[model samples]
Target: MLHAVIMAGGTGTRFWPASRAASPKQLLPLVGKSTMIRQTYERLEGLVPPEQTLIVTNQQLVEPIAEQIPELPVSQLVGEPCKRDTAPCIGLAALLVSRKDPDATMLVMPADHVIRSRNHFQSAVKQAVEMVGKSQAEIVTFGIKPTYPAEIFGYIHRGAAIDTRGDSAPSYVVKHFREKPNASTAAEYVSSGDYFWNSGIFIWKAKTILDALAAQQPEMLEHLKKIVDAWGTDKQDEVLEKEFTAIEGISIDYAVMEHAKNVAVIVAPYDWDDLGSWLSLARLLGTDRDENTIVGKHLGMNTKGTIIRSTDDHLVVTLGLKDCLVVHTPDATLVANKNDEESIRNIVKLLEQRGMTEYL
Candidate 1:
């Protein structure tokens, strides 16, 4: 059986005023009319149905997520009691899904990424499912074709191509993974043409990934074992809450995938964006003739290459400003250089210190 688990637990503090603790980026219509979470579910229509799809998010978000995605069965919404990071999120979802079907090949994807080409994305996922079904490998992550020398994203080096015909498409054994690089390194990687932007989307069978975790991260795996072992018993949820606390807060990339030798990379050709920070938001938005990405009602004067977004009806005017980001909400209005967009996370931290929870 094939199933998909969308990890929607991120806080998305970088997109502050717009994305708050109560409603994060996944629930907001950042890109278009629908929320990113809804887009993720819609993207998987033919690949996996709502019955086979699961959404893993924080316990606080369960009710709101359910409200946004009412089509999902209540049981399919897996909630984490605490923020245990990606390792536990993945492990918990895998454990729950495996309980229903042992042979489940799970497509573990993030809920916030914007993948434009639906047909291409679906084709790649279907191919990866067929490939993983036959292999004993533990994990498979999609690596987006690097369109530019982006220093923000990690890179995946492709190894020998699998023996598929020309129509076989771009699938490769991951040679090595690289952390975010400097400008020179990023340019070198882009010039080589083998490096891919790590999309953080994964695929693997439940048993295969569990075995790899057991091998590479025994401590995390042992803690997860206690939860899985209690499945179907009356003590499952209680045991899960307790035992999950004992696990370390680490990403699957650091705890397992980076160390596991069987990891594979499926080269995804579709346009993909993690939307990690405000800079990413500004970069990926649509622009008008004045070269401004205007979200709400706005009248600009000589504003070029700037993003001005406001939920309110307030009119925004920019005078002789280029490459700027202006975001206006009821609580706060932010004006910053577009080049320094990633620093918004630091601004969020400062707000937290000042006890500005109302604006956040």
Candidate 2:
């Protein structure tokens, strides 16, 4: 059996005003009529059934998530007591799936990503699952072929090929995972042609990942074991609340993937985007003939190469602006230069320092 684990705990502060703590970007209709999470779930239709799908999210988002994804059972929706990053999140999901079927394969992915070629995405996922089953690879990650030198995404260096008999999709040993680099470093990585953008989608057997966790992240494994033991009992929620917060806050990349020697990468044969910031959204929804991307009614005199989005029913007017980002909501609005999209995190912190909880 194969199960899907969707990680949807991110706050998405970069898309502030539109993405709030209660309703994150995953629950918003950013790209189309369906929400991001809904699209993610739908993409896994034939790959994994709803009964086998698990969603790990924050406690505050449980209700909205449940509402948005009613097909998933309430039991399958596990909420972390606190935000402990991807390591704990993946560990917890692994435990839950192991309880159901220890030998089951788990496909871990984020909810807020865009994949244009659904057929290719599914084909790549099938290849990854087969690679894990047939080869010695215990952990398989999907790596997107880099189109350009992008500094925002992490890089995956490919090593020697792992031959899978008669399988067309090539799999390679992960040489290493590198953090986001400078412009020059990114350029060099692209020119080398041996690197791929770390897509963060992973596949592994439930028991295999658990064994790896025992070796690399023993403490986290032990905590997860305690929770798994208490699951379905009267003390389930009680134990989760007490133990989840005690676990260290770290990412799976730091705690497991980077250290695991049995990791492999499968080149993703599809168009993908993490949608990390407003600029990414603009990139997806390109400019009109006037060199502007407007999601709502807008009257512009001299605006070129800008993105303007508003939720309320009002006309947004701009004059003599070029290459800017304007996001308007009922409560608050953000007007910034597109180059400063990465600084949205800083703006979020500033909001916190100024005690603006309502906006957050």
Candidate 3:
């Protein structure tokens, strides 16, 4: 059988007042009618049953997640005491699900990504599951076909092709993973035609991943093993709290996949976006012919290539502005040049430095 683990524990500070500690981006209806997390699981309906899906999130978000996706069983939703990153989260999910079905193929996905083509996305996942089922490979990640020279995203070099004979015909082996590059380097990657955007979506056998973890991230694997050994028993709470508290924070990319030689990449053709910042949302949503983007209630005069979003009932009026972003929430309003959207992280850093607790 197949199991999907949705990682949903991100703080989502880049979104600022719209995304806060109490309501992160995953739970907010920024993309469409439904929250990103709900849309993520909803897309996997016929491919994977509700019982087979697992949600790994923070302890604070457990109830909120439950309220959003009530179809998921209480036991299937795993929570970490703190944000220890994807390494521990994967280790925890691998341990829990492997116990139920050792041969289960796991599809690890972020809860906040937007995949436009739902049918194509599901077909790709089914193909990935079939591929992992037949091979000794421990892990596989989906690589999105690059549409632009995006410096904000990491790049993956594709190797030999995989037979994804679907309509999209996505192909690649992911020869190597590259960090986020400068504009010039990103342009080079775009011209080379061998680079794909790292989608951060992964699939693998639960037991096979555990074996890889034992080889690469041995110490972290041992820490997670203690909790797995106690699951379904009265000692689960005590062991989970003690072991997870002591575990170091690390991403699965650094701790496992980067070091594992048996890793593979499955090229996929789906309009995808991580929505890391408001700028990304603006581009994805696009603008009118006049180059004006408005969400919520807003009035614009002589504004071109500008994005205005407001959650409050108050009307936002922009005059003679071009290539800018204006976001108004109940608490804070953000005004920046459209080109400077990625630097909003600096604003977050400054808030942290100034000890502004309420804003974050």
Candidate 4:
């Protein structure tokens, strides 16, 4: 059986005001009519069924996510007791899938990305799954061709092509994984065609990943085993709360993918966007004649190269603002230079320190 695990635990502080603690970016309809997570589920229509699709999110978001994804079984929605980053998140899901069927193939993906081409995305995922079925590769991850020297995203270096059993899409062994680099280093990576943006999407057998975790991350694996043993029993939630807290918060990339030698990369054949920040949204929704990305009703006298978004019906009027980001919500409003988009997280921290919990 093939299962899909959608990682939806991110707080998305960069998209603050619009994205809050209770309701994150994955549940917001930032791009199209449907919420980001709903769009993600729809993309897997022909690939995986709703029953096999698992959503791993925060405990607070369980009910809201269930309401948004009514088709998904409430039992399949695994809620984390606390934030444990991607390593523990994927490990927990892997254990559950392994419990169902040890040989099950799991497709791990984030719920917040905006993928434009659904057909191509499905084809690529199917290709990766089929490739994994026939090959000895333990894990397969997707890599997007770099469009620019993005300093924020990690890069995957492509190694030599691996010999597959049949005529399949080109797959390369992963040479190395590079963390977010400085501008000069990022430019070097982009200049070399071997580097691809690490999409953070992965596919592997439930048991295979478990084996790797046992070798590379023994402590986390032990915790996962305890949780898996408790499944279907009354002690499941009790074990999860205790063991998950003990598991260290780390990314799967650093814990397994970067260290594992059996990893491979499938060059993604679709348009992908993480939708990480307001700058990304601005780029997706191109600027108007004044070079401003405006979502709601706004009247600007001399605003140029700015991004303005409002949820309320109130008309926003700007005066002589240029290259700015103005986001208006019911409780909070953010007005800053577009260059300061990366510092949105800092602003969120400031709000937290100032005891403005209502805005967050």
lDDT (CA) for every model shown? 0.84, 0.89, 0.85, 0.88
TM-score of each: 0.94, 0.96, 0.94, 0.96
- Per residue, candidate 3 scores C-alpha lDDT tens digits across 22-51 of 789999998888999999999898988988
Better of 2 and 3 by TM-score: 2
lDDT by residue (tens digit), candidate 1, 157-180: 988877544654578888898999
Overall local distance difference test of candidate 2: 0.89
The candidate, 1 or 2, that scores higher on TM-score is: 2
lDDT for predicted candidate 3 compared with the true structure: 0.85
Clash pairs (backbone) in predicted model 1: none
Clash tally, candidates in order: 0, 0, 0, 0
Q: Write the per-residue lDDT of candidate 4 for residues 166-194, one digit (tens) a residue.
A: 64556799999999999999999999899
lDDT of 2 by residue, 1-360 (tens): 889999999999989879888888999999988999999999998889999999999999889989998988999899899999998899889988988887899999999999887888888888888878886688899888898999999999999998865745677999999999999999999999999999999999988777877888899888888998999999999999988888988898888877788889987778899988887776788878977888888989989988999855878999999999999988888899988888888888998899998888
TM-score, candidate 1, is 0.94
Ranking by lDDT: 2, 4, 3, 1
Steric clash pairs (candidate 4): none
True-structure RMSD, every candidate = 1.9, 1.5, 1.9, 1.6
